[model samples]
Target: MADIQRLSLNQATVQNWSVKEAVDGCVRHGIPSIALWRHKIHEAGLQQSAQHVRDAGLHVSSVCRGGMFVAPSAAERKERIMDNFRAVEEAKELNADSLVMVVGASTEVPIADARQMVADGLAELVPYAREQGVKIGLEPLHPMYAGDRSVLNTIDQSLAMAAPYAADEVGLILDVFHIWWDPTVFEQIQRAAGRIFGFHACDWLVPLPDTLLGRGVMGDGVIDNHALRLAVDAAGYNGPIEVEIFNQALWDTPGDDVLNKVVERFTALV
Candidate 1:
C-alpha cells in the first residue's frame, strides 16, 4: 500500500472546493498535505487561507504557479516577472514547500528565443525566491502544451534549466501525466536526485478526452503510476506525493466523493 501519510490533495483535483473547504476535506479525510492554486487562495483571502491550513496543521506542499515568462514585448514580460515576485510573497505567506513554475511557451517569437526568455526569467526570479526562503519548482508540461502552455516539455529540459541554480533555490516538479511517456524518464528521474522538489501523479487517458482537462485519476488510465512513484522514491524525493488531476468529470463530481476516489486509487495504484 502507498503511504497515506505522503498523499497530498492538490486543489486542482477538487476544483470546486474553496481553500477552507479543501483544508477541511484534508482534515476529514486524513490527507496530511495540500497544493494550493493562487486563484483559490485569492478567493479565500491569502491570510485566511494560510490561517486555515495552519490551524488544521496541514502541510502546504506547493503553491501552484509562478511562471509564464514568454511574451512578445519587454513590458509584458516585466509584468509577468513582477507577478512572479508577488507569487514568491504568496508562497512565503503560506510557508509552502515550493512555488510551482509552469514556464511559458513561445509566443510570436522563435522557440529558441522563448526558451532564452524562460532562462532569463528564471535567472531573475530564482534569486528573489531564494531571498524569500522559497524554492522554485520548474514544471515541464507535456510536449503538446509546448506551443501554448510551456516551452519546458521534458524532465531533461527542466533539469537543464535548473542547472545554474542550487537545488534548493530551483528544482524540478515531475508530473507523471506530463512525463510518463518519455523514453529516458527513469534515467532523468535518477539524474534529478536532490533536485526534485515535488512529485505529481495522474494518469493519461488512452483516447485523451481533452488535452488540458482530460487527465485520469491514478489508476484510471495507462500510466504505471506505482512504478513511477517508486522511481521518484528511488530518486530521493521522500516528500508529499501530490494528486493533481485536471479532469472536468472529476471536477463535476462531489468534492468529497472525488477525494474518496483519489484515496482509493492512490492507495491501490500509486
Candidate 2:
C-alpha cells in the first residue's frame, strides 16, 4: 500500500470544492495534506482559508501557483514579478511547503528570449520568497504546453533554472503526468536529489481529451506512477505526493466521489 500519510490532495483535483469544503473533505477522508490554488484562496479569503487548514491540522503542501514570467514588454514582466511577490506572501501566510510555479510561455517573443525572461523573473522573485520564508517550486509542463502554458518543459531545463539558488529557496516540482515521457527523466530525478521539493501524481490519458485538462487519476491512464513515485522518493524527497488531476470529467464528478477514487487509486496504483 502507498504511504497514506504522505498523500496530498491538490485542490485542482477537486475543482468544484470550496476551500472550506476541500479542507473538510481531506479531514473526513483522513488525508494529511492539501495543495491550495490562489483563486480558491481568494474566493474564501486568504486569512480564513489559512485558519481553516490550520484548525484542521492539515499540511499545506504547496500554493498553486506563482509564475507567468513571459510577456511582450519589460514593464509587463516586472508586473509579473510583482505578482509573484504577492504569491510568496500568500504561501507564507498559509505556511505552505512551497509556492508552485507554472512558468508562462509566449509567442510574442522568441523561445530563447522567453526562457531568459523566466530566469530573470526567478532571479527577482527568489530573494523575496527567501525573505518571506517560502520556497519556490518550479514545475515543468509537458512539451505540448510549450507554446502557451510553459517554456520550461523538461527536468533538465527546470534543474538548470534552479541550479543558481539554494535548494530551500528554489526547487523542482515533478509531476508524473508532465515528465513521464521524458527519456532522461529518471536520470534527472536522481540528479535532482537534494532539490526535489514536490512530487505530483496523475496519469496521462491515452487519447487526450483536452490538452490542458486531460489528466487522469492514478490508474486511469498510461503512466507508471509507482515507479515514478519510487524514483522521487529515492531522490531524497520525503514530502507530500500530491494528486493534481485536471480532467473536466473528474471536475464534473462530485467532490466526495473524486476524493474516494483518488484515495483508492493512490493506494493501489501510486
Candidate 3:
C-alpha cells in the first residue's frame, strides 16, 4: 500500500493560512509532515513557527529554500552565501530533514555561467551544511523557468552537479510537477537513486499560465501521479510526498476547503 502517512503539507498551498493555522490543520487532518518557507517563518516569528509545527507533532520534511547562488558581482554572490548561512541556522533549529535549494536564474552573464556559479556555491555551502547538520536538496526547475528561476532544469543535470557534493548529507529535491514533462524522467530517477531526498508533488496543467500561477488538482492535471510516486518510492526514498502547488486561484480560497480537496486528491491518486 502507498504510505498516505508520507503526504506533507507544503506552506505555499495555504498562502492565506497563518503558521499556527496551517500546522493545526495538519494536526487535524493527520498529515504527517510539511515543508516550510522562510517568508512564512518571518511572518509568524521563527521560534513561534517552529514551535507550532513541533507542537502539532508534524515532521518538517524540509525548509523550502536557500540558494540563489548566481549573482552578477562577487559581493552579490557572497550575500547569497551569507543568506544561506541563516537558512542553515533556521533548519538546525527546526531539525528539518533538508534545506531545499533552487539554484538560481540566468543572469546577464549566461545560463552556463550562472550554472558554474551554482556549482561553486554548492562546493562551499555543502560542507557548511554538513557541519550545521542540514542537508541541501538541489531542485531542478522546469525548462520554461530556466531563464528567470533556475538554470538547472533537469533531474539528470541536477544529479550531475550534485554528484560532487556529499552523497549522504547533500542531495536533490525531486518535485514531480517540475520534471514530469521532461523526456527522461525515469532515467533521471534511476540515476538519482540514493541521492534523492524529498519527493515533492503537484499536478501540472497542459496550458500552464504565464509562469505565475496555474496548477491543476492532483487528478485534474495530465501528470500521472501514481507513476511519479512509484518512481520516487522505487528510488528508495521512503519520505514525505510533499505537496507544493502554486495555483493563484486555489490560494484565494479558504485553506480548509483547499486542504480538504488536497487530502482527498492525494489520497485517491497521488
Candidate 4:
C-alpha cells in the first residue's frame, strides 16, 4: 500500500470548503498534509489561516500560486511581481513546502516575448523567495491551456525556465493531468531529479471534456499512475502526492466524500 502520509488533499478538490474545514477534514481523515489556494487563505485572513493550520497539527505541502509574468506594460509586470512577493511571504508564514507558479500566457504578444517576461520576473522573484525561505515551483500547464492559462507548457520548458537558479530556489511541479500526454515525460522526470518540487495527480478524461473543469479521479481515466509514481520516485522525489482535481461534480459532492474518494483512489493507484 502507498503510505497515506504521502498523500495531500489539495483545497481545490473541494473548492467550497473553507481552510478550517479542509484542515479539519484532513485531520479527521488521517491525511497528514494539504495544498492551499491563495483565495482560500485570503478569505480566512493570512494570520488566522496560518494559526488554524498550525494549531490543527497539519503540514502545508504547498501554497496555490505565485506567477503570471505576462502583462501588457512595464508597470503591470511590476504589479504582478509585487503580488508574487506577497505570495512568498504568505508561504513563509504558513510554513509551506513551496509556492506553485503558473507562468502566464501571451494572447496578444509574441510567445517568445511572454516567455522572456516570465524569465525576467523569476530572475527578480527567485532571489526574494530564497531570502524568505520559500521555494518556487514552476508548474507547466497543458498545451491546451497554453493560449490563455500558461505559456510554460511542458516539464522540460519549466525546467529550462528554472535552470538559471539553484535547485533550492526554483523547481518543477509535475502534474499527471498536464504532462501525461508527453512522450518524453519519464525522460524529463529523470532530468528533473532533485528539482522536482511538487507532484499532483489527476487523470485526464476521454471524449476530452470541452471544459477544463473535467478532470477525473485517479484510476477513473487513462493515466498510468503507477508508472508515473515509479518514475518520480526513481527520480528521487519522496514528497507529498497532491490530489488536485477541478471537476464540478466532485466539488458539488460533500467535502468529506470527495476527500474519501481521493484517499481511496490515491491509495489504489499511486
Candidate 5:
C-alpha cells in the first residue's frame, strides 16, 4: 500500500474547495501534505492561509506556479518576472518545499526565443529563490500546452534548462499526465534522480474531448500509475506524491467526495 503520509492533494484537484476547506479536508482525510495554487491562497488571505495550513499540521509540498516568461515585449517580461518574485516570496512564507514554475507559452516570438526567455528569466529568479531558501521546480507541461500554457514540454528539456544551477536550487516537476507519453520518460526519471522536485499523479484520456479539463482520475484512464510510481521511487525521489488533476467533472463534485476518491485511487493504483 502507498504510504498515505507521502500522498498530497494539489488544490486544483478539488478546484471549488475554499483554501480553508481544502486544508481541513486534508487534515480530516489523513493527508499530511498539499500543493497549493495562487488564486486560492490569495482568496483565503496569505497570512491566514499559512496559519490554517500550519494549524492543520500540513506540509506544503510546493507552491503552484512562478513562471510564464514568454511575453510580447521587454516590459511585459519584466512584469511577469516581478509577479514571479512575489510568488517566490509566497512560497517561502508558506514554508513550501519548492516554487513550481509553469515556464511560459509560445507567443508571437519564435519558439526558440520563447525558450530563451524562460532561461533568461530563470537566471534572474533562481538566485532569489535560493536566497529565500526555496527550490525552483521547472515543470515541463505537455506539448499540447506549448502554444498557450508552456514552452518547456519535456523532461530532457526541463533538465537541460536547469543544468546551469545546482539540484538544490533548480529542480524538475514530473507530472505523469504530462510526461507519460514521452518515449524516454523512464530514462529521464533516472537522469533526474536527486533533481526530481515533486511527482504529480493524474491520468490522460484518449481522444481527449476537453484538453484542459479532460484529466481522468488515477486508474480511470490509460496511464500505468503503478509502473510510473515505481520508476520515480527507483529514481530516488522520496517526496510527496501530489495529485493534480484538472477535470471540470471532478471539480464540480463535492470536495470531500473528490478527495475520498483520490485517496482510494492513490491507494489502489498509485
Candidate 6:
C-alpha cells in the first residue's frame, strides 16, 4: 500500500451497505474519507448517521448529489431547489468536505437551455450553501449522458458554468470514469486548480452495454486511473480519492466485501 493517503468510498459504490455499515467499513479499512448519497442518510436519519461517522473519526468527503434543476413547471423547479437546500444541510450535518451536484439534463429542452436552468438553481442554492459552510462539487457526466443525466457534460464546460457560484463555497469533482477520453482533460485539470474539490475513479469498458451499468472495476477496463489521479494531484488537489464505480457485478456482492476490494485496488493503483 502507498504511504500517501488513498482510498475513499462513495456510498453508491457500496450501495448495499447501510449508512452505519459504510462508516464502519471505511474505518476498518483505514480510509480517511467518504462521500454519500442523500438516500443513505435519509434512510439512517441525519443525526444518528452523522454521529456514527464522526464517532468513527472519518471524514465525509461530499454528499453524492444535488442540482436536478431542469423541470417543466415552476413548482417542480422550486422543489428541486428545496431538495438541494436540504442536501446542503445534510452536508452541514455530516461535516462533509463538499456537496456533490449532478446538474441534470432535459432532453425536451435544448442543452444550452438546460444548462442555464442548472445555473439558475445553483444561483439560488449557492448562497445558502455558502452560509452553511458546505462547498458544492459539480460533477460533469460524460457527453454520452448529456441528453439524460447532465447538461454540464465536460470538465471545461462544467467549470465555465459553475465557476461563478464557486467561492470557498463551491467547486468541481473530476471523475476519470466520466472524463478520461476528453481531449482537454489535461488542461482543464490545470484550470480547475484550487477549485477541484474531489476525484472519483473507475474504468470504462470497451463494449459498453446499457450505457450506464457498464462501469468496469478499477483494473478491469481501459482507463488510466493512475494517470488521472496524478493529474488531480498535480492540479493541487490534496483531498480524498473517492472510488465511485457503478457496476452491476459489484452491486450483487455484499457491500462490505465490495468496499474491502475497492480499498485493496485503490491502494495498489493510486
Compose the digit string of candidate 4's lDDT tens values, residues 1-270. Answer: 468999998999999999999999999999999999999999999999999899988899999988999987999899999999999999999999999999888687688899899999999899899899999999999999878889999988888999999988899999999989999999999999989998999898886675588999998889998799889999999999899999998889999999888899888888
The 10-residue segment with the lowest total lDDT in model 6: 1-10
lDDT string for model 2 (80-136, tens) is 999899999999999999999999999888899999999999999998888889999
Query: Worst lDDT window (10 residues) for model 3?
Result: 208-217
Clashing pairs in 6: none
lDDT string for model 1 (24-126, tens) is 9999999999999999999999999999999999999999999999998999999999999999999999999999999897659778999999999998898
lDDT of 5 by residue, 7-82 (tens): 9999999899888999999988989999899999999989998999999999999999889999879999999989
Stronger candidate by TM-score (1 vs 6): 1
Q: What is the TM-score of candidate 1?
A: 0.99
What lDDT tens digits, residue by residue, belong to model 3 across residues 90-170?
988888999999988755759889999999998878888889889899998888888888998888888889888768877
Runs in model 5 deviating more than 4 A are none
lDDT for residue 100 in candidate 2, whole number 0-100? 97
Which regions in candidate 3 have their CA more than 4 angstroms from the true location? none
Residue 195 local lDDT, model 4: 96
TM-scores of the candidates are: 0.99, 0.99, 0.97, 0.98, 0.98, 0.95
Off by over 4 Å in 4: none
Report the candidate with higher TM-score, 3 versus 4: 4
What lDDT score goes with residue 160 in model 6?
81
Q: Which structure is stronger by lDDT: 3 or 5?
A: 5
In the order shown, the candidates' Cα RMSDs to the true structure are 0.7, 0.7, 1.1, 0.9, 0.8, 1.5
lDDT of each: 0.94, 0.94, 0.86, 0.92, 0.92, 0.84
